[model samples]
Target: MVQMIFLFAILALMTIVLMEANTVSARDCLSGTFGGPCWAWSGEKCRRLCIEERHVSGHCSGGMKCWCEGC
Candidate 1:
């Protein structure tokens, strides 16, 4: 039982470390465009954009350009 618990704890720690090391890549806002905005919630990542004029929210890494419409 103790060994099982220790194994679970180690597994949990490894999972956390893996998650923290993971990073999401930027998405394309406009077609033919290479870089755009990217959003990451938990371990998943997504690409989002705003039509017309609206406020958009997203997350990106360093040296990445974050684009949004409106204010």
Candidate 2:
């Protein structure tokens, strides 16, 4: 029973870590200058420039830039 509990605890920890590493928010895009839309990725911030020849969605807040897909 103790071993099972330990295993479960480890699994839970791994799950939590993975989730955090993969977690990302749209705010990252609006974090700094660029003052333009961007594509956010898991464990990564928005890209500096648009990848495709498409209109990205973004906003400028407090002189900062924020962006998201299909914004």
Candidate 3:
């Protein structure tokens, strides 16, 4: 019974922590594809283009797509 209560208390604390952590302010960013396709796309290149050209943050995501986030 004591162990169960301890476990429950820990779980409740974790839940509260997670809830607080999840309440972060999200950026209102615009997302779109960068270049042609994933075949010749690199993270550095994409990030550079996004930062320099579009003035935003960018990354090469899955499926060979360069995702750019503009605020």
Q: TM-score per candidate, in order?
A: 0.33, 0.35, 0.41
Worst 10 residues of 1 by lDDT: 38-47
Clashes of each: 0, 1, 1
TM-score of predicted model 1? 0.33
TM-score of predicted model 3?
0.41
Minimal lDDT window, size 10, model 3? 22-31
lDDT of 1 by residue, 2-23 (tens): 9999999999988866664343
Q: Local distance difference test, per candidate?
A: 0.40, 0.42, 0.58
Which residue pairs collide, candidate 3? Answer: 38-64
Clashing pairs in 1: none
Give candidate 2's TM-score: 0.35
Per-residue lDDT tens digits for candidate 2, residues 1-71, read 99999999999988876664443344334333343433233212333232231325432222223443442
Quick one: ranking by lDDT, best first? 3, 2, 1
| RMSD in Å for model 1 | 10.0
The sequence of per-residue lDDT tens digits that candidate 3 reaches over residues 6-68 is: 999999988876764443225322235455763343767777766865656666443455555
For TM-score, the strongest prediction is 3
- Candidate 1 or 2, higher lDDT? 2
